[model samples]
Target: MYQRLITSRHFVPLLAGFGAMLCITALSSLGSAVQSSVWLMAPFGATMVILFGLPESPLAQPRNIIVGHLLTTAIGLSVATLVGVTPWTLGLAVGLAVSLMMLTNTTHPPAGANPLVVMLAGEHWDFLLMPVAAGAILIVVFGVLYHRVISGKQYPKRWF
Candidate 1:
């Protein structure tokens, strides 16, 4: 029974969930003692799902996750500061982010929401550095370590 359970198709998925839990818990705890820091945002939950559960996917690549989040957030912040967040601007921001992500070859879908997050949350320029850049960097680092140490697999199939 134990061997069968270990070899079951669902075993890997269970492991992935466990991995995601650990990574998020670590990220959350590292935030302010009050756990109110932007260190863990909404999109990060989806990011974790991909990072831990589908590390082999191109969208889960470190470059994609980091660059995609940074680019979209920058675009959103710029638009929000300059034009403002009307329905049109919101669509414009997301469209531009998608197009640019495709062009840059860094299309992490979860990051597709960063623009909306920024616009709605009224995040300032500092947001790009804190939760956007810093958080993405830490997530990628932790994913690398987790996959290498726990899964015995190299994450990011390709660094480029």
Candidate 2:
């Protein structure tokens, strides 16, 4: 079963995605180092999967990536700040984030986790800047550059 899961066809895409994540994480590390701050977050791993493994997916598009993250982060921060990080509040925040993303047409599956991250960490507004906004933008920009220069796949099927 394990052998069947790993195939020759999966090698390059897997490698490419892995490499892209490495580059992205490394850049995040560099940003953290230079600024002496936390620039990495958990949700970005899922973002990388969508951006690199499913570049042609609608979720991988620039608009979805950026707006989805921004919206979800805003919701997460708002809920966390206003309601406090109770179990019920976290649930409500996640539900609201998902609903808002859908309503705004900025649905991104990875971003669904942002509410949990923010609430759990008790993060304030700056949480949106470093890991949410900066990380999402980096992933988009990296995916575009990596696919265009190295992988030769269209990074974004559409910008909007």
Lowest-sum lDDT 10-residue window in model 2: 1-10
TM-score of each: 0.91, 0.87
Which digits, one per residue and each the tens of the lDDT, describe model 2 over residues 37-143?
66677777787777877778888899898899888888888987786888898889899999998998889998899888888888888878877787778777878
- Clash list (residue pairs), candidate 1: none
What would the per-residue lDDT of candidate 1 be over residues 113-137, giving only the tens digit for each residue?
A: 9999999988899999987898899
Shift of residue 81 alpha carbon in model 1, Å: 1.2
Q: lDDT of candidate 1 vs native?
A: 0.87
Name model 2 segments beyond 4 Å from true. 1-8
Where does the lowest 10-residue lDDT sum fall in candidate 1? 1-10
TM-score of 1: 0.91
Model 1 regions more than 4 Å off: 1-7, 34-36
Top candidate, metric lDDT: 1
Q: Give candidate 2's error at residue 86 in angstroms.
A: 1.1
